[model samples]
Target chain A: MSGLITLVSLMYLVSAACYVIGLHMMRTPKTARNGNRVSAVGMIIAVIMTFLIVINKHEATMTGSIVLAAGLILGLAYGTIRARTVEMTDMPQLVSLFNAVGGGAAAAIGTFDYLSLTAGSHISFAFSFPVALDLVIGGVTFSGSLIATGKLAGNISGKPISFPGAKLLNAIVVIVIVAAVVLTIGFPVNAWWLVLTLVASLIFGILMTIPIGGADMPVVVSLLNAFTGLAVAMAGFVIDNQALIIAGALVGAAGTILTLQMAAAMNRSVMNIIAGGFGTGDSNSAAADDVPVNVKETSPDDVGVQLAYAQNVMIVPGYGLAAAQAQHEVAELAKLLTDHDINVNYAIHPVAGRMPGHMNVLLAEVNVPYDQMKQLEEANSMFENTDVSLVIGANDVTNPAARRKGTAITGMPILDIDKSKSVVVIKRSMSTGYAGIQNELFSDDQTHMLFADAKKGLQDIIASTKEYLDE
Target chain B: MSQELYTNIAIFVLSILVGFEVISKIPSTLHTPMMSGANAIHGVVVVGTILIALEAHSVLFYVIAFIAVFLASINVSGGYVVTDRMLQMFSKPKKTDDQKQDGGDK
Candidate 1:
């Protein structure tokens, strides 16, 4: 048993090392492909080792193996189907659901452990305490994560929805869970109390995360993730499993840090996040009145003409690119430009899309070469010397508003797209961004609004540029 | 040999497979945050370990439990810190002049 445990731990160590390599690779848009491959390898190794651990247990039975096989088959089918067909927009929701499952599984495992210990045997007060606590925390995390998944997927509103004394209500639930846990601990034979605690904890988790605003989803995801980790770690304790303990610890600490970072990014307090009700679907979808903004106008043919003849062209992508499903098309366009002997590069802002390095992942999906995807710092420097800056359906990140004072996003920094010599913006319409502010970039003298969906605009430009090449 | 143990093992295997399936669909954008957050919940290992130690009635058990708690705390704390830092950097602005001179958006 010791030897097998050692082997599994060693595999985990190797897997961790691979994760580090993969993280480094993600730093550059070009090397990101390689990074992903490395990470995949690590995951594969971890999976193999996990299997070995499960199989190597001396007392393994046939029922367990059958169960394992069923899970494996079901998981593979679901993952393959989703990976092949799930839209990029739904990715966050899928992830949240997945996280919930993991937490739920861990919590369920703890419950099973408790049930087994008590069944056909004597139960003591000492045994009941830990088991009760485990059931409570795990159950709470599981349900809470489910709600988070629902919210992210837009099945629920993303706005804060605080009711009168929601906090107090949540507090009372927590107290009930604690009280039940204490009862279970004080009377080990009281198995029913543990079950009751589980129910209460589950309710607490849902109430705790439901009211947070959409703007703070990233933070909510992080917090729930932390709860899941702690649940798993607690399970490790009940089973006296070293590997489980170590893995749980790693997860718990990481989740905490992520939650804190996400909260800080939005300039929000963690306490506020716990209080929930921040993003109760207010006016986020209400369209802003399109006040006429100055945008330099240009045609697809003209833009194509510029791209075909330019020495260098930098593609500045924003949330607009993701929304338009334009990444694949954009890659095709870049390829055409490359054939024309034009220097084509993608300048990606750090926070360009909804999440960190989102643009890189989107571009990578279309098989864009890593070297061509430049980070904001590297791309920002090159933009000044570039001949043309093509602005796709991005707004807030490119909005020069971040640079000026007295603005809502003030203290927030943005890409210096304004400094570009010729800025061509391809947007369906002039719309205000998530911050509910108008962008001055649209009005810049050097900027040209192409006024089209990014994908269609790119297609038109691609065809026009092809003509330019033919001529 | 125990049916309960078999049941537990079955559940564990099923959970992982389901987990992997769900994980694959997540957008790469939320990968760090999601992974880091889930890892935090695993900290419950410490609570479990501590509970076991309280019941130990043996010196070796106490030692093992203490070690588990210490390690779990570090993992939980370290992971959360790193994830938070990454998110913070993401929300900050890019340096200006580097972007200004480029005639076109890169």
Candidate 2:
């Protein structure tokens, strides 16, 4: 028995190392898939080892085996189908759902642990305390993630919803959760107070996310992800499980860093994120109004002509492009231009897609070569020497409004697409971005608006280019 | 704290440091996959869930554990599969052999 336990522990160590290596391998594109494979193998090993332990225990029950098998099948089917079928534009909601279920499970574990310990009224201070934190954080992550998914999916208004006493109400909810937690600790023998804390924490999660507007959804999602990580770590502490501890701590720290990155990209502090309400989600853009801005309109043929002859062309994509699933069409266009000897490249903003790396993944799905994709910095310099800049379903990132003082996007970095000799923008409507701000680039003399769905726009441009080039 | 608990804490703290180091190295372009990958990695909690659920005594524990076990497994399996699918899209062979001798560093 001892030997088998030791072997299982060693396998877990191996699994942890694999996760670390897998994440590290993500640094480069070539090794990323292999890295993912490594992590999956690690998880499989960990699952097998745990199953072995369950079977070997003297009180081995068929209940555990049946439950494990059932969960694995359902989870595998749901996850595989969702991942395979989901559109690139919907990645945000999918990820939010993933974070939600994961956190909810962790909280359930915490709740179960606490209940089991206290059913006999033998709760230890050390064990009960972390479980308290686990329940609160996990509960918050679960509900908060669900709300974020709702906002992104448009099921709920992405506009910041405020009540008469939202901030005060939130404060009260926090107080209640905290007070319940303290009471449970004070009277460690009773599990009744723990339920109160759990319910309060869950409500608090909903309250916290409700007032956050759409522009901040990315940050909120990332923040909830971090919260889940922390809760999982707390659950590990309650159970004294090393695998859970290591995985949880790693996730907690990583989620936090990602959240900070998302926040910084929007020129907001982490505190502002927690407070949310940065954008109204009320207007098409944050500052969109009746002020009619002058803009040039160009046909796809003209844009196609420019793309064909330009020494260099850079494509700047945004959430709109993903929504249209135009990556393959855009890629086809880029390929056509490349064949005609035009240098084509893609510019990726740090916070471009609904989630991080969102554009990259979508483009990769269309088999866009990684060599052509440039980061914000790399593409910034290229925009200057470029002849044509193709803007697809993107707004704020290219809106010169970000650079000016006193504007909503002040201090928010933007792509220098205006520097190109000629600019063409394809968009579905005149709607302002999530921030509800109008883009100054739309009115520039060098820029021409080809108002259309991004995929259709790209297709028109591609078709025109083929005919124009062949002639 | 007990010796075992102390050791576990040490592991937790060290893993935090290691995680920050590795995650920082990832570029912004890979952030989504990195986020998803980490999401999958944290599914390790299912082991803890399974351990607790099997020994559950009362009906309350049984129902709660059942749900927890299912949710945890979903997180674990779904996270990995999704991440893998996304990563697979990244390593396609380049079509143009013109050899621009460009400066793309991964």
Candidate 3:
């Protein structure tokens, strides 16, 4: 029996090693796919070893084992099918959904363990403490992630939703949760305190997320992801499994760094985002009244001729481009220009799309060379030398308003598309962006607005450019 | 606390340092995939669910364990698969021979 235990421990150690090595390999895109494979391999080993332990123990009833097997098979099928079929445009929703499940599972494990231990006789303070922590963190993650998924999927309004006394209510929820957790730690056998903790935690999660607008989802999702990891680590303590503790802690760290990165990209603190109520939805009414008189509107044919004759062109894409599914169209136009010996590059802002690296994924799907994709710093540096900058369905990221003080997006880092000699913007209307502010770049002397949907606008430009090239 | 608990704490702290060190250096372009990948790793909670199932004698315990198992499996399988799909696109840009040729035609 001891030898078998030793073997299982060694296997877990091996699996943990694989996780570390695999994550290290993810530093470069070239090795990232293999990194995922390596991590999956580690998971397989851990699962198989766990199964062997269960079989040797012979403690599981026949019905219990059958039910477990059924759950495993069904879950595997559902997850595999969804992952295989989900579109890149819907990646944020899928990721949020996954966070929900992972959090739910961790909370469930903690609850069950606590119940069973209490049924057996005396439960220790150490045991109940981790279980309580796990329940709180996991419960919040489960409910918060669900709300985030709903917003992303368009089932719930993406605008920040707040009611009277919402802040006071959030305060009450936090106080209740903290008091319940303390009571649970003191009285390990009483389940009522833990129940209160779980309920309040779930409510707290919903309250925390609903007031955050869609623009901050990347940071919100990353924060919930980190919460899920912390919950899992607490579950590890409850189960006394080193594998869980290690893997969970690693993920917790990764999520923290990502959340910080996302927050920094927008020049907002994580605390401010959590405070919520940033964007007021797509309020075109207020923006229309404030529209500057200097806005220059242009035509697709004129823009096409300008692009065709330009020496260097930079394409700056935002969430609107992804919303209109215009990646392929833009890629085609860029290709036509490249064929004509016109220098073309894509300037990608870090928070340009719904999630981190979202624009990169969308463009990569259309076979845009990764090398042509420029980061914020590199793109900013090249804007001055660029002959014409094509702004596609993007708003706040390129707004010169971000450079000045007192605006909603004030102090935020923006793409330097205005520095180019000539600028062309494609949009549906003079509406504001997610930040709900007028983009000063739209009223610049060199800026020309081509009012159209991103896909249609790009297609028209491509057609006109093709005609010119053919002649 | 017990010796076992002490060792677990040590392992947890060390793993966190390693995670931050390795992940902080990754480029912004891969942040999405990195996030999804980390999401899959925490799916190790499946082990906890399976461990509890072996001890579940009552109907209530069994039900909870079953749900936990199902959710953890999805978190594991779905996360890794989706992350791989995204990374596949990232890796595709390396073999740009066809795209280069298409762009080269005057």
State the lDDT at A231 in candidate 3.
Answer: 92
Docking class of 1: incorrect
Error of 2 at A78 (Å): 2.2
For model 2, the stretches where C-alpha displacement exceeds 4 angstroms are A119-122, A279-286, A290-292, B94-106
Candidate 3 global lDDT: 0.88
Candidate 1 per-residue lDDT, tens place, A1-471, comes to 898878876886676555445544544334434554564465556556766655565333444344344444454454445444546555455545545655665555555555445434555543454467567767877788788778766688765666888869888998898888877666544456757788898898889777765545666666766566556755755675534544454455555655665555444578866765422334333324445555567899999888888888999888678778898789888878886788998887654654444575567556565567776677778878888899887776677867777554565546678787778889887766656667888888888889899999999999999998894
RMSD of 1: 11.1
Candidate 3 per-residue lDDT over residues A1-471, each given as its tens digit: 788889999999998888888888888888989998999899999999999899898989998898789879988889999999998889999999999999999999888887776542556777878988999999999999999999988899998888989989999999999999888777646767768988999999999999988889989999999999999999999999988998999999999999999899899999999998653334444554687778989998999889889999999998889889898898889989998999999999988888888888898888787789999999999999999999998888899988887677878888999999999999999877778778899999999999999999999999888877784
lDDT for each candidate structure: 0.61, 0.82, 0.88
User: What are the per-model C-alpha RMSD values against the true structure?
Assistant: 11.1, 3.5, 2.3
- Superior by TM-score: candidate 2 or candidate 3: 3
lDDT of 2 by residue, B1-106 (tens): 7787778778989999998999987887788888888998888888888888777766677778778888887788778888887777776545333233443432
Candidates' DockQ values?
0.07, 0.60, 0.81
Which candidate number would show the highest lDDT if scored against the true structure?
A: 3
Residues A1-471 of candidate 2 have per-residue lDDT tens digits of: 999989999999999998899888988878887898898888889888988888888453566556656766776677778878877678888888888888898899888877766354656677778888899999999999999899888899988888888888998999999999887776655677878988999999899889887667768878887887888888888887778888888888899899888888888887876786654445334356644468888889899888877889999998888778898899899889887888999998877867777888888878778878898888988998999999998888888878888676789878889888888999877787766677889899899999899989998999989987893
Model 3: native contacts recovered, as a fraction: 0.84
Candidate 1: list runs displaced more than 4 Å: A1-69, A84-90, A117-141, A147-197, A200-227, A253-298, B1-106
